[model samples]
Target: MYWFLLLMAGVFESAFAIGLKLSDGFSKPVPSLLTAIAIALSMLMMSLAMRGIPVATAYAVWVGIGVAGSLTLSYLFLKEPINSMQLISVALILFGVLGLKVTSTG
Candidate 1:
């Protein structure tokens, strides 16, 4: 359950990061509002996750999700470069996250 919450927090962190770009420096009201909301939700979820998951492990997982999700979003929506290196890095993050999940479950 806490891991799930951690994942959701990561997703929200990604959302708000993308939302920040979409908001164009908060010039656009709707996207900016979404960015704010998403950020708040991410923090809330991460705090909840910390209750069960070790702080170090949870932070690593959270960062993994944010990095992977944000990169994908940037590639697909923002026309950012998506090269082999980028994909490989994302995969590495996934592996690390999975390792944390598996090993920490005990």
Candidate 2:
């Protein structure tokens, strides 16, 4: 359950990042508000996940998910083209996340 919450927190992190980008520097009200909501939810989920997981592991995983998710989501939503270098970087981050999960207990 805590692991799931950590993943959810990461997803929320991605949502807020996209929302921030879409907000055009907060000039847009809707996206700005959505960004705020996402940020709150992300922090909440992270806090909940920390109850069962070590802080370092949970924080790293959350950030990993956010980075990988945001990269893909940005390409999809913003029509940004992802180059080979970025793809490799994301792949590495994913691998690192997997490594952390495999090594971590509780």
Candidate 3:
């Protein structure tokens, strides 16, 4: 359950990141509000997950997920270019996250 929450937090973090891009530096009202909500929810879920997951592991996983998700979303929706090196880097981050999960006690 905590792992799931952590994943959700990471997903929300991605959402807020995309929202921020769409918000034009918070000039847009609706996207800005939504981004703020996502940020709050992401933090709350991450905090809850920390109760069961080690702080270091949880933080690393959360950041990995957020970074990977944001990069993928940007590539797909924003038409951003993705090189082989970027793909390899994202794969490495995913592997690190998986390693932490497998080694975690909770």
Global lDDT of each candidate: 0.94, 0.94, 0.96
Output the worst ten-in-a-row residue range by lDDT, candidate 1.
Answer: 97-106
Residues 1-106 of candidate 3 have per-residue lDDT tens digits of 9999999999999989998998999999999999999999999999999999999999999999999999999898888899999999999999999999999998
Task: Estimate TM-scores for all models.
Answer: 0.95, 0.96, 0.97
Indicate whether candidate 1 or candidate 3 has the larger TM-score. 3
- Which regions of candidate 2 deviate over 4 angstroms? none
Using lDDT as the yardstick, the better of models 1 and 3 is 3
Cα miss at 3, model 2 (Å)?
0.5
Compared with the true structure, what per-residue lDDT tens digits does model 2 show for residues 51-95?
998999999999999999999999999998899999999899889
C-alpha root-mean-square deviation, each candidate: 1.2, 0.7, 0.7
Model 3 / residue 56 / CA error / Å: 0.5
Compared with the true structure, the alpha-carbon lDDT of candidate 1 equals 0.94
TM-score of 2: 0.96
lDDT of 1 by residue, 1-106 (tens): 8988999999999999899999999999999999999999999999999999999999999999999999989888999888898899899999999999999952
